[model samples]
Target: MQRQLIQPYLLVLGIALTLSSCFNEPNYPDTPSADFKGIFKYTIAAGTGVGAAKRDSVVLTIGFKDGDGNLGNDIPVPKADSARYAQNGGWGNYQIRTFRLINKQYVELVQDVNKVLFFPDLTKGKPKGAIEGTIDFRQIFTYGSSFKMYPTKFQIKIRDRSLNESNVVETDTISVPFPN
Candidate 1:
C-alpha cells in the first residue's frame, strides 16, 4: 500500500516539476513583439582602476531601435567616451544587448549579427531582459563588462567587472501607455 502511494506522489512531483519549469518563464522569440518601439537608453556607472591611464568617454549616441526595440546600430565609441585610468595603462570592455519590451525584457543594442551577450541565455532565468555586468579594465584598450538590461525605466544593477566583484542596481517602475 505504501509503495502504491509513494509511486503516485513521485509521479506527481515529477510532472509538477516539469510543468512548473515550463510556465516559470514567458515564451519569447528572438524577434521583437510587433508594434513595440522606443528609444531606451542604457547608462553604465563607470569604474576605475588603481594604476591605469585615464581617458574620456565617447558619449555614444545609439542609433536604431527596432520594432521590438532591438538596437541595430554602432554605438559610436568616440575617443572621448573611453576609460580613463588613474595611472599608466589598463583596459575596459563593455557589452550592451539592445530590446525586449515584455518577453526577453530589453532592447538589444546589437552592432554585430554574429554575437549575443545577454537575454538570449534563457537557460538561467525568465526571459525578461537583463543588464549583464561591468568592468574597469581587463587589459589596455579593453573594458570587460556585461549586464542584463531591463526596459520600462533605466536602471543599472548587477555590475560584474573582471569576472569578480559585482553590484546589482535597484529600480522602480515607470508606466508607458501601450501603443495602439
Candidate 2:
C-alpha cells in the first residue's frame, strides 16, 4: 500500500515538471513589430451586371509580435464617436500601404476611397503577456483595360494600442494579372 501511494505521487510530480518545462514565457519588445511572411494571388468573380468580372485578389500574410499583447482594438467606435478617436490614429490598428512597380520604380498607389482595417483584441479575457501571430490581409484590384499585367508589392506595419508603430516590412514583388 505504501509503495503504490509513493508511485502515484511520483508520477504526478514528473508530469507537472515536464509541463512546466515545456512552456516558457516569451520575451519581446513592448513596441509591436511585423514581418512579411508571404503573398498569394488569385482570380475571383466580382459583380453581375452583364457577366461577372474577373478581378485579381491578393492576400498578404504578415507575422507580428507584441510584448504587452496590446496590439488590437477591443471594441469598434461608433460612427458618431469616430471623430474622438481620430487623434489616436483613427479606429484601425492595422495600417497598410499599396505600391506598384512603374518604370522600374515603386510608386504608392492611392485608392479613391480609404480602406481601413483593424485587428481584434488579442488578449481578450486572458492575462496580458507577450504574443506573436500571423494575419492575412486581402485586397481586390480592378485594373484598367490599358494594362494587362503589373508587378506589385505592399508595405505593412502594425500599431499597438499605445500608438507605437512597428518596423515596415515589404513583400516580394508579384506579377498581378488583369483579366478582360
Scored by lDDT, the top model is 2
Residue 135 lDDT in candidate 1: 19
Top model by TM-score, which number? Answer: 2
The per-prediction tally of clashing pairs is 48, 0
Instruction: List the candidate 2 regions with Cα displacement exceeding 4 Å.
Output: 50-52, 78-85, 89-91, 112-115, 143-147, 177-180
Candidate 1 lDDT (Cα, whole model)?
A: 0.30
lDDT to native, each model: 0.30, 0.78
lDDT of 2 by residue, 124-173 (tens): 88889999999898887765554567788888778876778899889998
For candidate 1, the TM-score is 0.20
Error at 108, model 2, angstroms? 0.8
Measured over all alpha carbons after superposition, the RMSD of each candidate to the real structure, in angstroms, is: 17.5, 3.1
